[model samples]
Target: MRLAAALISCVLCVTGTVGGAWLSRPASVDYGSLLSKASDIYAVTDERGDATRLYVVNNASNAAISRIPGAAAELPWKVNVTYSLDGPNVEANEISGASGLVGIYIDVKPQSSAANHTIPVVTFTVPTQVTGDISADNTASVATQGSDIVVAAAGNVSSGLKFSCYMDAKK
Candidate 1:
């Protein structure tokens, strides 16, 4: 009886330790590699020159869309989108109640051949209203599916929602 009890306790201790370690592990994301394949990415700006959208050159005529867009295409550059939910990089106050506003910043750099030019960073705000179609996971996630930069934040609402917006990489 004594030997059995000691063995059970030892097993329980090992199992608990392993479970705790696995549960407490911190998660990480590789932002740099996310948009590494994106090229000829442009920042769409309003009449005032404020970035309102992102456009990736595909087979369409980017120049005919509007000359007001950022110089990413003119400079023939690639872009990196740095995104956030609620922190220094995000506009935390704008995400109150039903307001689903997210702050997005894009870094535009010249191609490797034009390395001498300066890097341009454009900032903008996008509305990601919550909807029933989304699942409530209480966490934020982002990814580039084809030409779209999909941002889903399920923590804000009960049913959760997603913002399948940005980068009209029309083929």
Candidate 2:
């Protein structure tokens, strides 16, 4: 009789725990386009002090369905943007050289999220432009807490003129 009672208790405990987790998530997450929010949004600026925001634009709701299997350590997000500058007064060479005025880059890892929210797991200057010499394709990564996995990414661009920055994460 005691064995049966304990088995029943274990099943109920598991069900309750799973149910509670499902309920804790924001309701909008159920029907909205946002798949998930791995960490709070962050703002990154350039040498000229123009600021652009960063966040995971799209994330997997579950590990089995993740588009970024390599980023399994933390939810993966897309940093998509385009920046441009053209003016009659400005020199063509100057515009072409500094075309990618704003950069947004991130390697979604667990530590960069809720666990060590006080500090950035990694930090470095944003690449000023996409040039053969500068190598805007530079990358970085962080280790996952539970696995041997690492998350990595290269810089992404956003437009500018005299260095202005903006982010569109409402979607």
Q: Give me the candidate number with maximum TM-score.
A: 1
lDDT of each: 0.34, 0.28
| CA lDDT for candidate 2 | 0.28
Count backbone overlaps in model 1.
Answer: 0
C-alpha TM-scores of all predictions? 0.19, 0.16
The true-versus-predicted C-alpha distance at residue 104 of model 2, in Å, is 8.5
Candidate with top lDDT is 1
In the range 1-171, model 2's lDDT, one tens digit per residue, is 111111100111111221121113335535233424343333455668777744443433432322344446452222222343432233334444454333333232222223222212222222312321222222332222222222222222211101122222110
| TM-score of model 1 (CA atoms) | 0.19
Error of 2 at 88 (Å): 14
* lDDT (10s digit) by residue, model 1, range 64-159: 544553454443344445444433344434334422323444334444443333322221222233321222122333333334333332111111
Q: Which ten residues in a row have the lowest lDDT in candidate 1?
A: 1-10
